[model samples]
Target: MKHLKIIALLLRNSLMSHLEYRFSFIMWSITSILWIMLTLISIEFIFGHVNSIAGWTKNQMLLIATVFGIFSSIMWMFFLPSAINITKLVRKGTLDFYLLKPIGNRFLLSTNQFSLDNFPRACILVLIMFGLIDSMGLKISFLSWIQFILFLLIGLGIFYNIFFTAAVTSIWFIDIFNLEDLYANILNVGRLPTHIFEGFTKLSFMFILPVMFVATFPAQILLGTADITMAITGLVILIQDLRGKSMNFLGFSH
Candidate 1:
């Protein structure tokens, strides 16, 4: 309860700070809306000719885009900045500030800061996604909804572990900016459907890097293309990865 209140207070303060800079906030919101619109337009253009791209209709692709945007927004607003900076903090020995805190270290690291500026973009993406789905009269079953949520949770879990593992390694490297971008590129590969790729490329994305979790699996659920077994496998893998020890093999283990 106390922690929830603290989080609520932090969120409130952050939102208030944004409102204090009303014009900047509004401008940022408008820019994000325009960007999402342009992206949706591009997807439409690609699927305009073919009835389906790799068995996914335009609406199915839009769902994937929405899931991508939502997850990506969450990462952008919270995880990326903090994870990237943790490398510098570790190098400088300033991580002691976080370690000294009387709370869970990983949770502290995860939610120490929240960015109000990114919420507008996430909200817009969700609105667009839901609006499109609803317009199509796509009957989303309870089971499918559950699978979508489950895959989304697992996807984020995988994403966090991968990033955490990378950032922990950067404690020794010191120059991690480029490495972070490479990780982003891996996630970007899944911004579209895995069906579009063939043979080795599909296999690599699906298993080797597991970037397919970022959008592909959840998109399948939303499009009624996912089976129960696949969703269960994803959730199981995510849980196992979460429980496994994070090894900083590249960097000196701290």
Candidate 2:
């Protein structure tokens, strides 16, 4: 409960800070919507020439894209700022202040910064998802909805663990400031159907980088073609990775 209160306070402060610059926030929200539209337009253009890409229908592709947009918006809202700030903190030699705090450094660092600007984008993506489902005539069961939400949550955790792991490496490589941009580029690939990849590339994305977890699996759940074994395997791998990284962070702080 104490930690929950701290998180609430952090969110309030962050929201207030963003609200202070209302014009900037509004502009950011507009830009986010434009970006999402541009992505959808590109997909539409591609489907104009091909009936289906990798056996994924136009609506299916749109669903995956929408899911990716939501995941991206959430990451930008809650994690991206902190991931970038961690690098700055490391470079400035001020990370120890967070380490000395009563709260866990990992929790503190992850929640210290938030971007409320992406909230509108997340909402828009969700609406778009519903529209896609309706147009596709998908009859998603209640169990499928539960599974979709669960996979999304798991995907968010896995993404944070992977990105946080990369960000914390700034402790050793302070000059690698472009890691966030690189990570963003990699994640953009999740907007496409994972079926487009073959053999080694598919395996690499699934297990090595696990970008598929970011959207593909959750989208699959909605499509009624989810691979439970694959999702479970990815979740297990994420748990192991998070556990190992948590130990590493603790060791570094001490």
Candidate 3:
């Protein structure tokens, strides 16, 4: 409960800060919607020439894109802003501010710069998802719905582990060269069906990049095609990172 209250306070303060700059918030909404549309267009154009890629029809592809959008907004809302910018703090030696705080540094670093704009962006994605579901006539069961949400959270955890690792690496490297680009490339793979890759490519993504579990595996769970191995792997990856990093899941150790 104490942690929850702290997170809530952080969110409230960040929202207040965002409210002070309404223009940035408005511009972000526009760009976010446009980005989603562009993603749809690119997927549709590819489908126009081929019936399906890796057995995913146009509707399935759209669903994947929607999941990707929601996940992107979630990162933007919290992780993206903080994780990407930590390099700046590392370089400037200002991380002591967070370290000196009474609370956990990991929580402070990750949630310190919450962007409220993505809240509405996530809502817009939900509306789009419902419209897509209605058009496709997908008969998702109550249990599948629950699994979808469960796996989504699981996927988010795995994603944070990978992304948090990247931020930690920045502290050591000091020249984190194209950190955002690295994450974006990995995130892009999740929007596509995992089966689309073969041999080395597939192994690299499934294990090394790990975005396959982050986005594709959860969508597969909802589609009734995901395997249990990937589920276990995701859990193990999260636990392994927590143990290896700092014996604490937050990455920074003092």
Q: What's the number of clashes in each of the models?
A: 0, 0, 0
Model 1: per-residue Cα lDDT over 94-175, one tens digit each: 8879777877666566556667788899998889878978987888999888878777777777777778777766666777
TM-score of each: 0.85, 0.95, 0.89
Query: How many clashes show up in model 3?
Result: 0
Q: Candidate 1: deviation at residue 9, Å?
A: 3.7
lDDT, candidates in the order shown: 0.75, 0.86, 0.77
Clashing pairs in 2: none
Candidate 3 residue-wise lDDT, 42-85, digit = tens? 88898899998889988888887888888877876878778887
Cα RMSD of predicted structure 2: 1.6
Compared with the true structure, model 2 gives a TM-score of 0.95
Query: Candidate 3 has what TM-score?
Result: 0.89
Off by over 4 Å in 3: 246-254
Better of 1 and 2 by lDDT: 2
